[model samples]
Target: MRLYAIGDIHGQLDKLLEAHDRIQTEAGHDAVIAHVGDLIDRGPDSRGVVEHLMRGRDAGRNWIVVRGNHDRFLPAFLERPDWIDPGLSSGQHWIDHPGLGAAQTLASYGVDPGLDREALLREVRRAVPPDHARFLATLPLWHLHPLALVVHAGIRPGVGLLDQAEQDLVWIRQGFLDSDADFGPLVVHGHTALDSAAHHGNRLNLDGGAGYGRPLCAAVIEPRGAHLLTGKGRVPLVPEMTG
Candidate 1:
């Protein structure tokens, strides 16, 4: 089976549609598409991105979406607009960081994050419907296939796939990114943005920094190996050895 794992969308609905088109034209209906989270924020049309995925899932399309750190923020912020987890991002509130891009997300829903706290909460609550809230809230942390593991971020080193911490799965960096430990199967992930999709022997980083005005990318993975589904065509993904 061909598994097409998409990189962080970051609210780029047009790119998401383009990626889907590539998959449909190249791989056809039998292939599975795993959206590697961060579906919203930074770019335009966060709401549209969510609705598009939801529509696909509702139509029984083979789509899997994992949660990203930015994904978690929207639901968290909706519940407590002023909430901030100091442990994550050095106490930066979701809306406070331009990188997190919650303001853009709010803009997608026709709400303003700049309004005073009470009014902001009210406007956001009214703008975001419950179904959308539930959609974001209930997303899985990871999707495991026999040939690959799909996660928003790299997994914790030395931990069993089932034993990885939730935070590490969506927010981890140094320990997982720097390690060269074999993770059994190829770990397909996003979170750390890059110029393009890359492989590091143990894993693949597909995020092309779409939130930063870069193109979104997806990889077609099979038991034998993997290749990125680029605009030009398939580009082979060759994993590099790391320490």
Candidate 2:
């Protein structure tokens, strides 16, 4: 069974579908497609993206969806409009923060984020479907495969997978990125976007910053190695080639 990991989608539904088409063509319909989360925000069609994935799951497609920090924004804010994640984009509200892209997310649901706080929250609550809210709120932080661990962001160094904090699983950076520690299975994540996929030996980052107008990336992972699934076909993904 081949495992393909897709990077942060950030509401890029077209790219997500295109990647799915390529995966089906290259690896067959039975291949497992692991979404590295951040499926919403920063793009034009958050609602469509969520609906498409939901429908796919309903049809029993081989898909794995993990939670990303941006995935938490709408649900958290809908619960408490004043909520702010105390991470990198601390202080600013989720919708107001350029990096978070909640405005675009709300817009996808036909809600105007420019409305007053109370009105905005009310409009969003009315716009978003109950199932969509439930889907975002209930997403897991990680999915452990025999060959690799899929997560929205890299795990914390020096901590066991069971002991990793939820925030670190979705929003961490500082300690995890620079470390050489091995967590048994390869850590596959997408939070920190790079221009291309990265193979750091111990971990793999597949985010190509689709939110920043770059391409969405996906990698084909084998038991021993991996390759970037491209339009032209597989490209060997190695530390030297990535850097």
TM-score of each: 0.96, 0.96
56: Cα error in model 2, Å: 0.9
Off by over 4 Å in 2: 240-243
- Write out the backbone clash pairs for model 2: none
- Candidate 1 on 54-110: residue-level lDDT in tens? 999999999999998788888888887777855375677887775678898999999
Our model 1 lands, by Cα RMSD against the true structure, at 1.2
Task: After superposing candidate 1 on the true structure, give the runs of residues whose Cα lies further than 4 Å from its correct spot.
Answer: none
> CA lDDT of each candidate?
0.89, 0.89
Per-model tally of clashing residue pairs: 0, 0
